[model samples]
Target: MEVNRFESINEGTILLIDKPYGWTSFDVVGKLRSLIKKYTGDKSTKIGHAGTLDPLATGLLVICTGKATKRVVDLTADSKEYIAKIKLGETTPSFDLETKIDATYPFDHVNRELVETVLKTFTGSQMQEPPAFSAKYVNGKRAYEYARKGVDPKLEPVPIEIQSIELVGFDLPSLVIKILCSKGTYIRALARDIGKALNTGAHLVELRRTRSGVFSIEQALSIAEVEKKLSNMCNQS
Candidate 1:
């Protein structure tokens, strides 16, 4: 069922937001919390996001407010879809552009056919290691903390499913792909593995979450739009 935007603060509702790049998932929640408090004068209203998207990525973010926050676990369990661009011939410790390139390789041997075949190998359940610069907790500290200190935490691999991988576009060194995968699947890790398979190092240059479960970017509102709506609501009250 679609939620009514004009519902009372105590009435739960789900919000689909087009999270802007450079903004963390927690940043969205914080902004919305302030808006709700200003509009409804309810400082204690609960607001949470279903999943976490990296600050460097943009797109659909499922935000739950009021009683709807209770379903966050169920919402996060759904499959996710993403469109990413990987740059061949180079790799970074963080797997994405968040970190500087640590090494380079020759991409002369990489081609369209080779990429298609390599993607096929990843279209099933497999064990994947999360990136070192990730939110994964280790001994109560974030994995990135250990990575920043030059400590290799040696995170264990976990099972993940890649439902589908479609090659959207491919140039010699840059490849664009659309992926549908189960929860916990990391595109950064996939980029790294693809490079390894091609005998050329690679890393993610860009990434966007297009869908999460039943929510799609098409139905999501931008931060500015949400803020404007909340402002109007405040005036109406």
Candidate 2:
């Protein structure tokens, strides 16, 4: 059945966007809002994203528009899947490449067997502390804001579930793994913990969200693609 763009958008629509690197989740929302306004001529259309992806990470970002905004909670609550590349022998305040290396350790003892064993320990429910440089609010300010000013915020460990972790590639100093975790799980923190388990330090180098609930990267559209689609819809209108 052919759907009318205005009617569909006004009612509700879930947009699966492939968020580009270096762009905050809010950037995607703002860009889409502009395109939507241009297309529908409605400036007050509701739009929001289900989850926030760090500027360093990229992949499927579930964006809900119009009445679909109500589904943001449900969408964010779903299991998330990610492929991460963690660099061992180094630690960073941000737990990822977003920050400079603060410390380093000998990773010579790390091997495939050790990696597998350490990953096993992270399976199931556990309390994990978020990175100091995270969006987590602290004292009415974002944690990252404190981190930027050379201040450490006291962040409590939150309970999270790790459904599974599979070693995709294992090379000395670099471990590529695929993870399926519950909402609120931080891959950067996981990387830091994994390094600790091995008696070494580690930090996330590359991370991508391959899936969120039923939405996969395969179903996501780039910002440009979305813009074009909206433009076409506007022309049709």
Candidate 3:
């Protein structure tokens, strides 16, 4: 059989990777594609990510190779969990640190009680406007294309469900939250909405996907680890 079967990749294999900050999802996929081709000499190997992770965020990213690429849809449909750090009293155009702060607000009136109350309202089904600087496609082009050019394009809201949100840390001006949400939910947008509901502007500073479907960060491999595995595969092949 041409299949190496290492990691049971004969037909397909799902790799849970702890994606590092600054590495885009495509970057990981590209790196793996090159590695697999180098190790197994299978130039036809197909690879793809279940979902796209922003370049700034870090966490468990589901990567599929070979025939597993066919399961991208179902893998992406899985619920996800994230640990997000949000900055109150500020707003960014990108909703995260990807862009400069566009505005600021007084968070002095915002308190813990208000935070908890507002977060409760966010749980359940609601319509969410994705950040203009997101990967959303508009008229066959990316929404960020308009956003980066200061062109305001009409982006419609999408239905998203937030199963639960927990306030992990609550020091003024900075909030840490753990969120369990359905697919397509953007935590950066959640930070934006939370800031609005709290009567203060807010933006995301950091985000990490702790869990996705049945996969957890605890079971994920780092880039170095992935490289090691590929090296072993190369030697075995």
- Worst lDDT 10-window in candidate 1: 1-10
- What's the TM for model 1? 0.97
Candidate 2: stretches off by over 4 Å: 1-7
Q: What is the per-residue lDDT of model 2 for residues 44-93, given as tens digits with 9 covering 90 to 100?
A: 98989998899999998998888888989998999999999999999988
Candidate 1 residue lDDT tens string, 1-237: 584364654578999999999999999999988878877778898988998999999999999888899999999999999999999999999999999999999999988999999999999899999999999999999999999999987888999999999999998799999999999988999999999999999999999999999888898998788878887887776
Candidate 3 shows a clash count of: 0
**Residue pairs in clash, model 2:** none
Identify the leading candidate in terms of lDDT.
1
lDDT agreement of model 1 with the native: 0.91
In candidate 2 the C-alpha lDDT for residue 118 amounts to 86
Root-mean-square deviation of each candidate, in angstroms? 1.1, 2.1, 2.7
Model 3 has an lDDT value of 0.88
